[model samples]
Target: MGKKSRKNVFTPEQLLSSLMDNIPDHIYFKDAQSRFIRTNRAQARFLGLAKPEDAIGKTDHDFFAHADEALADEQNILRSGKPLVGKIERVRYGKGPIVSVSTTKAPITDSTGKAIGIVGITRDINDRMLEEERLKSAQEELENTVRTIDMELNIARNIQESMLPERLDQIDEVKVAALYIPCSTIGGDLYDVIQIDEDRIALLILDVMGHGIPAALIAAMAKVSFTKHIARGLKPRTVLREVNDELIAHLKNERFLTVFLGIVDKARKEFVFARASHPPALLLRKRRRTVVRLSGKGIFIGFAPRYKYEEERVPLESGDIILLYTDGLVECRNKGGVFYGLKRLERLLLKHRDAPVDELVKRIREAHVEFMGDVPPSDDIAVLIATLE
Candidate 1:
């Protein structure tokens, strides 16, 4: 080794000078009195100073005139006697907007390790902090919307539930089994049972030709009108007539209703059914162990200014069952987007025909699940399983 070179080993100041220039972060040294000692190129740029020399002896207050804020940070770092790391907000020297500065202030001690000064590194995290704030605001807005939707849906669900018959026990030699599942928080499909003079039982299944809150509103109105007209001893056809007029008057041109209304006479064991622009219903006869479908007639209610349907009668024998439903059952799609059509439903009905009302519901639900195979219900499903004992 050369004698002169060996004697001139690197000094602490030389090593620190090398470190300041090589570091990517904006690093600086401050005296015990909060004055700048040495700073890097990045630090100078961050402070909007043309050169490191311009910032070397200045304080944070000198660079940033936001007096109270700069003082608070200096006090915290000095009193803590430890590094204070956090986000500090400041309007950048010449930048258009306020910026978030992530800073770390470490204690630089002497030989005895007593604090002598501060060494700081800073970064501009304005973009990240702004993004976080935007996400927070969006999340809050979404939460607010969810809360409002929940409140509204809960009210609608309660109203729909109220419209349904209370005593699910049984009705006049017939046991009623029904299920209503909405694809969303609310649904457009509905059904109900009503007793007229203890002899005739009115069964109604209505699909409002659409989904969501709009359909629900129409279904609710139809329910109110049905109650009013049926109380006047109006037949199923007459009740539907009045309901159709009222719906056409209220609903928009694009909307209509497909419905099935029937009266089951306990004494006669007869079911007189009327339909309006709906799919066929299923009749499961325990005697034949077979399922039969009867298609509905006429256009959907609320379509034209006037519409009517003729009544059809079926002699309900012992163990005869009538299954009414919205087309949602057959129209339901799988993950592959293929529907579980009428044929599949008929076969499923045949397989579970003799199952009890509740069991039949379970079977139907299971079939729907298996058919859908991990897909969401494509639409609302409304089921009504009634049996003549």
Candidate 2:
């Protein structure tokens, strides 16, 4: 037979003492009067005492800086015979600094289940609380920075919109209408109908390489330069050359613009325009009931400081319509990723050839919206329409 087995057992007092001494968290028991009846070594140390016995018979008010709230909570637990679990609080013991702790307290009951005392456990949560506070502060700072940026962008957008022509006057026999839409708060597309003299008006549209703050700044610079050059009575090709030179001088090679500058010579009944890597201008002839593209060859502005732009002349007849637009119009994609190409634009123009120039502008904008559906244009769009009546 095997040797008789021996069972290792501990008394109730020995088990309680072992658990109270070994656990790192503070543990304590209190009478209904909220006076401490017993405390663990951890609780005594937390209260700046040398041993657990030193905490016996003392109340939290005797050692804690803010103990009124704690005493009230303990009384509530005693009266209700309920437990308060995982309550996070900031507390100070003796003369120590305030620390965050998570505390749990439950009513102690006798054999008949009558409340007789309270038992509690507390764990330090200072580090976790500090980290959470730091994260909340950072989140507030980020939100404030975002609000500041959005406000500035809105102001910039207003300034940019103010730089565009508020009204396109019917200079002599040329009637002009324009529409502009930006994909963001600010855009890089610019257009203007500036009167050079009594018989001539310069119609210009340009698209910077990208959109947003950087592109918007370049667009503003281009608008100012273009207006200044046109004010000097420069022709279409000369305006393009001067604007190109101005941009190349001040800007790095990373930024460039596609420009279409045209001068409507009402006296000669002709439209002479220059292109800088821009889409061709479309002419809708009411007499022929057809649309044609006035093509020209030129490089984008800012490509070369001294590059010369070529110009083309199209004699205008009564009721002829001319459409100048940025690539955003042709490059706009639908949900299916199909481009609203130049062919479709030309067809739309033909369909609305007999409408007034302003009415025709409205029609084109409507068509674009219908084609896009819920899909937004990926770039800024600018359209300028002119009619000879």
The TM-score measured for candidate 1 stands at 0.76
In model 2, what is the error at residue 6, expressed in angstroms? 15
lDDT of 2 by residue, 1-389 (tens): 23333233667798899999999899999999989999999999999999999988899889986688989999899888899999999998878899999999999999989888999999999999999999999999999999987887786677668768888857867899999877755667889999889999888999888655777788889999999999999878888898889889767788899989888888899999899988989999999998989778888888898888887898999999989999999999999899999999999999888899889889989999999999987887899999888
Cα lDDT of candidate 2 equals 0.88
What is the Cα-based TM-score of model 2?
0.84
Model 1: runs farther than 4 Å from truth? 1-26, 40-50, 65-82, 86-98, 109-115, 168-177, 180-184, 197-199, 209-212, 233-238, 265-270, 328-380
Clashing pairs in 1: none
Residue-by-residue lDDT tens digits, candidate 1, 132-226? 99999999999999898788787767766666666653566788888866676566688887777676777888887765557667888988888
Q: What would the TM-scores of all predictions be? A: 0.76, 0.84
How much lDDT does each candidate structure score?
0.79, 0.88
